[model samples]
Target: MPDEIYLPMYPGEDGLTATIRVNGHDFTGLTLELEVRARGSKNPVVLSTETGELSLDLPDGIIVHYGAELIEALPDGRQTTIDLFSVSGTARKKIGAGYITIGHAGHMLTASLSIVEVPGIQGPRGWAPLFAAVAYGDSVVMRVADWTGGGGDKPSVGQYLGPDGLVDDIAEATDFRGGVGLTPDISVLSTATLDAGQDADVVLDPDSTPEEPKLRFSIPRGEVGRTPDISILPTTTLAPGQPADVVLGPGSTPEEPKLAFFLPAGAQGLPGAPGEPLLLVVSDTVDTGLGGWWVTRDYHAAATCQYLRAEMLVGAATGVTLAVRKNGATVRSGIALGAGVTTITDLGLVLAKGDQVSLHREGGGTLAGPWVMMVQIDGRAP
Candidate 1:
């Protein structure tokens, strides 16, 4: 074997034989020793028949074996070094050496060897194509291998793969135009009414057999209830001076019930005391020759008064004007008086509480002596 002998081989190849020839004669009775590794890797892998990586045909050749794991570990464009040695017990002798180049299968094939012709082998007779079919039950009866019409009635019967491979279905029929050999039936069996307040139930009849099943509905009857009796009665009375109100009382009787109302009355006021006769007096004596007016007397009414009237008495005067004012406002005026008494009846005035009344006198230019006037007002105050 040459030291520089280079043999190219691919990864993942099995049963590859390399003849171990020494001067045209087989190297017999020699135990195989082989070392394989990537070209530059320090760790080397050993191959032998004991390791199950290679097997030896004694005096013939060495067969190398590889798998997908070796193919992945050794890549294309990287080289593997292989060293072969013959071993007899502990003695080892170096034999042929070479490089195994891992590459694709056809990467190193020569043009002449690439297209080698292969001879054909004889085979059995071909099968004829299908000719006719017809619907029988769920499946169709088909006739095939009838290319030569030797016998007209004799036909092969079988099933075929539908477009999606389901049995007995045809590809050309999109809708169901044929029967499926069965029909379902449904009907109501019975209906029963139960008493009120029971649960409603619906059951399927004939539990042992599923075909032609019937439904049974159980319903409950509704009952009419009694009407409620109602009544409003005034039963309790409240004393006077209490807050006035109406309240609902407890019902009377059990079967024929009645509702009662208790009403309280408001307090009644006492009759007012007899109206008292009230008199408010205003009196003054004035002799103003300069013709000036004087408010003689004023009085505020301490209580409400009604039915008012005024009386005035003048001793003497050359000329004078007199008027009665309520709260400084004139309510009665133009009372002509020279002497004696002048009465103004039906004053038609009501004096509210805190009302002030005054007597005003204006003297004329010829006013003589002291003008003496006394006025009295009367009303009923309540």
Candidate 2:
């Protein structure tokens, strides 16, 4: 084996195939040692290969291919190329990272080679391409330092870097340009002033002690065909030592506020003003004689009135049928009074001025004593 044998190769391209001859004799199954070293690195990566048939009649030679698995084991940094060599027995030959070297007898062969660095396999956190693909317009959100008008600070209104790498000012206003503070003199005006041609300014002074402002509102005076409905207004304040006089407008009558009161038991309220007088047209009590039906009495109304009430008393009889008629026709009927029962019926009948009202009754079974029947009519002008 020679002390040092140089063999050219490429780093990032196809692996190299090396053929070694064993002096025209079969040396199959012979173990060979392979050593690889990256340029400028002291530590060398090592592997092993076995002799195999290099040609039909050259079974004594061995073949070796340089692959990426060996190159990736190098440290994470830059390297110009990798230097590799193999040793069989006492013979040694140098092979570049990406080349095919064939050795015969004492002569060595070399070829230009290429070497490529494979990126390390990583999980999400170690992905560099993912972070590189993200740009400003890609809507990638990240928590960054707050803007402080310093290097790499977030862009703000009127502050940006131009295409020429110079700091340029943006003319548009930003939402946060205003400082964090309220105005000292803030004035509020009613929208109604737009049409009324009146100006009302309510100023707020932040530096001084808070005080209420005086406010007054009124409707214009005019002759209105109908009264306008009352409206609710917001609470207003009055200035100190300010006198306010609230006079009712024309045709406006203010009534007394309703007072809570309780009426005593059986207390009579004040009678209302005189209305149409009520007259009793019929008032009579008679017996429903024996076992026969009879017409008790008839009364003609001279003025408009209503049938006010009727009282019937059946005396020791099974039952008594009492009825009332208007203008000789039955208007009210089907009133049955049980034996010894007294009942009062109030009828609300609107009668013209010339309507006649009559009372009739029939005794059930033989009525004893007098079955008193009384009917009364009012003179209400219905």
Give the number of the best model, judged by lDDT. Answer: 1
Q: What is the C-alpha RMSD of each candidate to the true structure, in Å?
A: 40.4, 32.3
Q: Rate residue 45 of model 1 by lDDT.
A: 68
> How do the residues 158-273 of candidate 2 rate in per-residue lDDT, one tens digit apiece?
23333343233322212222355653443332222232434444443344433433333332333323322322122222432232212233343223111111111111112322
> Which residue pairs come into collision in candidate 1?
none
Weakest lDDT window of 10 consecutive positions for candidate 2: 258-267
- Supply candidate 1's per-residue lDDT for 7: 41
**Tens digit of per-residue lDDT, candidate 1, span 1-382:** 2322234444443543333322233535546666666655567767766666666554544555655545554557555666676666778666555555555665441100011111122233354445466564465544332444333344343434344432444433223235565555767788899999988898888652456768898998878554334444554555533432323345545443444433232222123222233333332333543323444333344433233333332225544566666777777666544544454544444555556656666434343322223343544321
Stretches of candidate 2 off by over 4 Å are: 1-308, 312-317, 338-346, 362-366, 379-382
C-alpha lDDT score of every prediction, in listed order: 0.47, 0.37
TM-score of candidate 1 on Cα atoms, chains taken together: 0.23
